[model samples]
Target: MTLEENAREHPYEPVPGDVVRDAATRRVGRVMDRMGLRVQLRPLNGGREWDAMPQDLSPASQSDAMSAAVAEANAQSWRGR
Candidate 1:
């Protein structure tokens, strides 16, 4: 299978916009899809798993912070795996 297929089968990486609510740590993922940057999101009450892309994400003021967090999460995830 191709690399993408392999990743899908064994998702060692997190996809962009995955709502991660693991225990006390909670975050909405805002990944740089091309770079696979996984940012931690500020918790919300409840919403769909996928959200608008960072460029088109609502409440645009937070885009920069979200992107930075995603980059950090991507780095950390890659290192851990």
Candidate 2:
């Protein structure tokens, strides 16, 4: 499919707490919440939240997903949370 079509039909459909990547800013974050037509995303490492249009984001790249998953696993192992 075309790029615009793909962007519109983005497969992720982010939910709160799920990780996502913004196309415009190239920022990877966790979905925090939704407000109207915008989605709120917070830094995966904990920081201020930002608003982004859901259509502007895609699923995190495989490498990024792996890195985040490894980090999360390590954090869970260390913190027991």
Compared with the true structure, all predictions reach lDDT values of 0.42, 0.79
Any runs in candidate 1 off by more than 4 Å, and if so which?
1-60
Quote the lDDT for 10 in model 1: 62
Which candidate has the top score in lDDT? Answer: 2
- For 1-81, candidate 2 gives per-residue lDDT tens digits of 998788667555789878888887777888999999999987676757899998787778778866765775687678864
Could you give candidate 1's per-residue lDDT for residues 60-80 as a string of tens digits? 236544654667667767877
Scored by TM-score, the top model is 2
For every candidate, C-alpha RMSD to the true structure in Å: 15.1, 5.1
Error of 1 at 75 (Å): 0.4
